[model samples]
Target: MKNIFKFWKKYSFVLLIAFITLSLFDLRFALAAVICMAAPVFSAVFKGRFWCGNLCPRGNFYDNVVAKFSRKKKVPEFLKSYLFRVLVLVLMMTVFILGIKQNWGDLYGIGLVFYRMIVITTIIGIVMSFVYNHRTWCHFCPMGTISSLVSKSRKNKHVLNVSADCVSCKICERQCSLGIIPYEYKGELLNHADCIQCGKCAVVCPKNAIGYKST
Candidate 1:
């Protein structure tokens, strides 16, 4: 089970590749992006953004592939500001719903809408990754924001707790892809809305200070 999870973490980016490539020949493959879109929100009901950290194909692509080219700088402040994120969420959702309605039952046309969405967003995300952190796009991604919102109502969602053994070395800060500094969260039940529950911080904590918990 562990190895299977590892394999998935390592190779799930291929789904992104296949979707972009094969869809050129058969746009019906564009529907596959729905899996990418819906999976994160569904999982967020139980574990905030867990799918973004572990299973999102585009996220995997950014971490595994785009990271190699990224400057790895801190994401810009305005991009992560509450108003900005909300605006992005509203705009993207509005556009997506309008497109879906416009195309309605025309399979080919709807597929084109999805195709355009994926290609354009992927291109923009890739460009942003090069200019900033690999996960820069994730800071305000519509799907990611929705997942975080969904997790807010779940009382028993997963979180990372800092144990008394913690030495506050701050090493976990470096491992987080979206700048979620785990060591900085001092509470016994720390569930930062943006935290993706990747457990990378827990793995690297020399003091064995961090563990999964629930609020």
Candidate 2:
């Protein structure tokens, strides 16, 4: 996991490129969404937020744009939860009820609109990060929200630090990009919904504590 950027791990980058390329065609974009929906299923089945933690450009964007700056002043947890959920609901309603069609004329038009949407989302998320945490956009991320719900419903359990070897260094907690406080969890399952399963915590654990499997 430490060599996360090695060969096969680069599939995340490929997925991002595929998403962008598919945005040129509405059918393809829809297909991409369907494929993305499968990400958490795979994560739950295998072990990780394989898409978001590793492949998601949006996640990386937040890490670079927000987390890099605000190490000391973490965003208040409640604001990221309730307030952000409200904003996401509003935005979702706007998009769903209004059906803002940005596709103008040709394939280029479609791609342009999709590109603009991505940029706007990135911009808003980055701005929100100044006031919130790295997951400011995650509050509104449709894909992530969907993934979280699905993974939960599926009961795809992951094996966290469930052994006696755990030294309680809290490295897992600190390395967790999902903002999970690992020491608090007592069950074999890592119940934190925000957990993306990027495997960073597992990789960084000095005691080799964390592991995952499908239930």
Candidate 3:
């Protein structure tokens, strides 16, 4: 966990750079949202969320900015429920599509809708981090969820591997950024769909039992 945090911190400024284009630039900058979404989705097919852990600007923002002042409470169980995540995903995407349809002709109008979405969602993530754990919002983020699903689409996708020597210490579970219980899927791939390929579990395991494998 320490190593992973240190790694992301080293490049955390990327979030600020990306946010500047999204917020400080013209309406056209809102198109950045699509690129951001696509980056992770495309990577998930071959790498199982490598983009999320290594390159997601918002994830970096949470780790670097929000973690500083977060209250660090346990995430609400309701927020982690699959039903709730699906509902949030459906609702947000519905709103986005509707907004796009409403402004189908004018580029500025479409950009305005995207801009509003990025701003509102980011604020929600930041507020949730302060209210709960720094990564509370990550557990069910639409983009993360989508990346997980896309990764799962391929058989034998690379994921955190738990070897026979695992000490069952549960450190990996505790350190997982998305609250995934890695220990539960012992001697196999982690069963959870939110791994993010962060490798924090592998980094913190005292037994040196966790590693990545196609399984």
Best by the lDDT measure: 1
Assess the local accuracy of residue 77 in candidate 2 as a C-alpha lDDT between 0 and 100: 70
Model 2 residue runs over 4 Å out of place are: 1-48, 64-67, 70-72, 86-90, 100-113, 158-161, 213-215
Query: By lDDT, highest first, what's the ranking?
Result: 1, 3, 2
* Residue-by-residue lDDT tens digits, candidate 1, 106-179: 87788888999989888888999888888888888888888878876674346678777777888989887788
- 123-188, model 2: which lDDT tens digit per residue? 776677766566666655666665665565665555344345566788877776557776565335
Best model per TM-score: 1
In Å, residue 200's CA in model 1 sits off its true spot by: 1.9
What overall lDDT, based on C-alpha atoms, would model 3 receive against the true structure? 0.77
lDDT of each: 0.83, 0.58, 0.77
- What is the TM-score of candidate 1? 0.94
Could you estimate the TM-score for every candidate?
A: 0.94, 0.67, 0.85
> If candidate 2 were superposed on the true structure by all CA atoms, what would the RMSD be?
4.8
Task: Rank the models by TM-score, top first.
Answer: 1, 3, 2
